[model samples]
Target: MQRTFLQPDDVRDLVTDQFGGGRRPIALDRLTGGSKKGVYRLRLDDHSTAILYVWSAGENYWPPSLTVPDDPFTDASGAELFAVSHAALVAAGVGTPQVLALVRGSRYFDADVALVEDAGVDTLEAVMERDPGAAVGPLSALGDGLRRLHTTVGAEYGKLAAVARGEASQRRRVEDVIVDRALGQLRGAAAHDGRIAEAHDRIAGHVRHLRGAVAERRAYGLIHGELGPDHVLVSPAGEPLIIDIEGLAYFDVEWEHAWLQLRFGDAYPMLRPVDLDPHRLRLYRYAQVLSLIEGPLRIADTDFPERQWMLDLAERNIAKALAAV
Candidate 1:
């Protein structure tokens, strides 16, 4: 298994190139990374922080041969779209880290990397670890921010609305090509066969209900394709900022809303519902589990706990999907 690792020197060059004799970076350290990129925090002499995002093929340090489609809804340029999107959202009144400079380099380690200003952001997941109840404020803030962002996505990309709608309408066509197809490959590569067949039956049921529910709604317009706890941030004052909006796409509004309920309801105790439909919320929870089982397999380390959490969600969704079927 190959992976991209950013050394101290790599960060220094990135800072030097972007900052350019303005202020020499005093120190650099690895912060966090996703499946495709590694982030680093560059500390200036003034003690301010700038975040650097390095794109990589995977953990393998191998460059990806595949190219993402240049769709307005999807993030094809990797960090370019995210860095720009985050900056755009911030300028548009959403809470996002400031972009000091955006620099792109070819094959820094395994993938291209971008250096961005650090926002002192602690993911909602990290916040929940210390104070689970703090999520409400952030979650609420995130909701407001997402609403704003979804609006921008719809307005700014009005010219590309047809393209976005095309993708959404052709979603089933790409389902196997993008998701199910990749998951199939992963299944063959990594041999972890638990209750796959049973899981499929449950997922089928949930899909049925989800489709019907979507049909009933007029149209939610563009939404965050992936909206889980990890993608949200709770500021110190309890205000929420929704990060990682590159997954922006034209989808059912419930797709994004459901994620909040699942993470807050199941993972952390902070999210107690006072006025939301628990049953409908359960649909999003199940959707997440089914997707988790599908591909990439990004989650926590504890397998049993993760499995149980997703299974419980899947079962609930299965019942709903079956009802629709």
Candidate 2:
């Protein structure tokens, strides 16, 4: 197992500092499913539990093709951006863990840590997998939750850091970001295979045309860039709470809807409403697939299991995108 950044002693001390002395954490159970952060369930001396999220230092969670800055602690001073985003979601009446404390670059952990209330809810993915038939309620609740989330908007369409710092002028358009990234990935993949290179040339014009079409009709809102079944937790009573607000951004709502549809369209058809433009959604879907394959394609070899799967997926998505065009 990879060594976790947050230790038990560190959790105990953090809890004690937030709640005062003598309230030490009795247990620290590392939770799974985070890609770039360590999540732990910390049990306090009083038996209450909290969620500790330790941010990884300088890890790029997104594909290398994307232009997101490499800075790990993009959150403002004392993790102000992180705290503000969570607070905004809570204020919007969305179900989220109450942020108890935001530890910015602690010496002990050497990373930013957030202590939040543990909701002790099962993830929507878990519920869906365990009982597919009973997943309708939670899926519907998730749709409604997304509707509420989209209502929270930002001043510009980019990283929260740039927007919060009055640097929105430097922000790029969502359409441009997607198309540029897809082009870069497709070009790189093309270099490895003649078929991929041919497909890249064919898709290049289609991507640009689709980008223009979508840009003319895009609506901006707060989108959970990485929202999926796993990010949604459901209470015993069936209410859904969204976690992993790190990817939150103001962008085309179609991007979020497209991603949700790509992941859960068949399992939960109602997850995607019927009104979204099919062409734009397909464009985003193509962009998403390109993004997924970039990391694995960047590798020099295809012997790894993940690399082979990503290559196969890339082919399928390329065909799908071409057929749509």
CA lDDT, every model vs. true structure: 0.50, 0.67
What is the RMSD of candidate 1?
6.6
Predicted candidate 1 versus true structure: per-residue lDDT over 177-282, tens digit per residue:
2233323423321333344543555445444454344322233344556666677666566666665555555444445566655566565334332333444345
TM-score of each: 0.66, 0.80
lDDT digits (tens) for residues 1-325 of candidate 2: 2243455786656777788896887778877555456678988878888888777643223233334342211232235556766876777777777788888887656778888878775888888889986788878767766777776665567655556776554345556767876787777667766666767767788778777766454456777776788888887777778888876666767778878877775764656443566767768877777655554555425223245565676667656655755
Residue pairs with clashing backbones, model 2: none
Give me the overall lDDT of model 2.
Answer: 0.67
How does candidate 1 fare on TM-score? Answer: 0.66
